[model samples]
Target chain A: MSGAHLLVRVGETTAALPAAAVRRVVRSLRLHPLPGAGEGLLGLAEFAGEPLAVLDLARLMGAAGVAGASPAVTVVTWIGPAGDRELVGLAVDEALEVAELDLGAAAAGAGEVLVAERPVRLVDLERLGEEA
Target chain B: MSPELVVVRRAGALWGVPAAAVAAIERGPEGVTVRLAGGRELGAEAVVGLSGEVSVRGLAPPVRRRLPPAVAGLALWNSEPVAVLGVAAAPAGGRR
Candidate 1:
């Protein structure tokens, strides 16, 4: 990655969502649970007096024990393709840091970015809306 | 134009039934009776009457496929989400 990425902790793993798409990393949101909502959706929350959909990032990554985890931050981001972007919130365990990393030797679709000798998955935000 | 909705607590979450789809709503000791225009009456709780201009956010396809058939979309009441109910979508009874 030649650009800045927002690194965060989702469950026990480190992941990155491009900084350009990240609008804010706020304190844990007071999310209103949606009854009968699927596991993917955390629930709706208020941001600037608007209802925002908050998704469980750890659950999307197939991480375990997300229900028991106390999410510390809500990463507000706009995902989806250009001109058709949708703003959504990601409930993550912690907000690490914004890092500038170089992935010159890795191939496209390799999925992992080397951060401090650890492999951090480059989160495919588009899938957040599409995934089951 | 968004129709006025009868926001009620049902099954589990807060649900909104279009006022146009409701024939009458009467509160008693049991709870609120959301009588539909089609002559079917369903029991609901915490009936918040005559909500106007409830802008709904259509559920994504993945979420839609998983939701109950009665759910139309999601909207807000005092900044909290209320599942907007389509016609004939109100819960029959019971808190699920």
Candidate 2:
């Protein structure tokens, strides 16, 4: 089956998330740190007047932490099955364009697609939500 | 005594796989190939022959404790830490 994927740069690597899962991509916003927030969570940001947890996709993928400064954009995404959706913001260094991915039926696990000749890690939002 | 380990580099990180678990090591045009016992082949930047036991002590926790499901854990190599990715975990695009 074919599906749209939003390509974004997390640190030096490129990653893709299902376009249907992404609500919107927004420029950097003021963040409010949540003390004692567990791993992968950078902080909190307000999206559409609701508090959204910001996740560090780079860190989540086992990449080194982003140095120098925070990401410039956040891709808001919906996780979990319909009727139980949760909103989350993914911090990305750059918001790349969307691409129509073949998403073959065999697609499963983490590393499953190559976009623009670079291996793109497929973010499993449902699994991530369960972890969170 | 420490266990023997096979060291390989991937995605700029050093990984240590138990030597017993490695089925074969081959060189390819793109990079070295590590064949695990389970029949999975992984591209490696460099594969160092079996080495002595590695001390797990004093290794810091991964920056993100809950790594992507594919990663097994992080371990130190030559005084630096690298992620030890799960061999059974298929690469992006399912081994394409």
Candidate 3:
């Protein structure tokens, strides 16, 4: 329990996602597909009549496959560019609760992170929207 | 209303089933027959309910569990409590 928040898994094993990057977690939804979309875009989903871009976090994390959209968590994040925030949706294996951790509590490596004492790939939320 | 279950057509064509539709969700070793929304009961090995949606992943055919708004409760597998989340229908495609 440091400055960084700890992630409570839906099942077992503690995984961490940046609190600042997450807006809210919701149940899985049918993602509307965008013609000629890239790899990360799970598809398009409408929330309250407003269309939202959904990104498959499980695929991005290498946890699941393309059809693994079922039983996933939708994390709405705001990507800011020059103070402009663009909203995006991320689908994960599950929505784990958030916990805070100290910045100096663990080691930090390039493209690598030891979150909550668990080794995981550090995701760059900012670059998530870019075409891969 | 309970959210709609998101369904998708996976990539890589295989016997009328796309590879994308084949999720890696775990089906229970001991499968159970479940009656879901569409008045259809399917035999599934394992099912996971989170937030409010119940998903029967890991099946070869890939069962997309849809929970209607009227249904609200914990999903029991082998008499154990599982995560429950809201369910919703994905757009025409899914995720992107």
Candidate-wise lDDT, in order: 0.73, 0.62, 0.40
Indicate the docking level reached by candidate 1: acceptable
Q: Candidate 2, residues A1-132: lDDT per residue as tens digits?
A: 878889988878888888988999998765544333457766545566554556777777676655534568889887655554556677888888898876773185345677667777777666553443
DockQ by candidate, in order: 0.44, 0.02, 0.02
Greater TM-score among 1 and 3 belongs to 1
TM-score of model 3 relative to the true fold?
A: 0.46
Off by over 4 Å in 1: A67-70, A81-84, A101-109, B39-42, B61-66, B88-94
Pairs with steric clashes in candidate 2? A111-B91, A111-B92, A111-B93, A112-B92, A112-B93, A113-B92, A113-B93
Note the B-chain TM-score for every model.
Answer: 0.83, 0.67, 0.23
CAPRI level of candidate 2: incorrect
Ranking by TM-score: 1, 2, 3
True-contact fraction in model 2 equals 0.03
Task: For candidate 2, please provide the TM-score of chain A on its own.
Answer: 0.85
lDDT of 3 at B31: 45
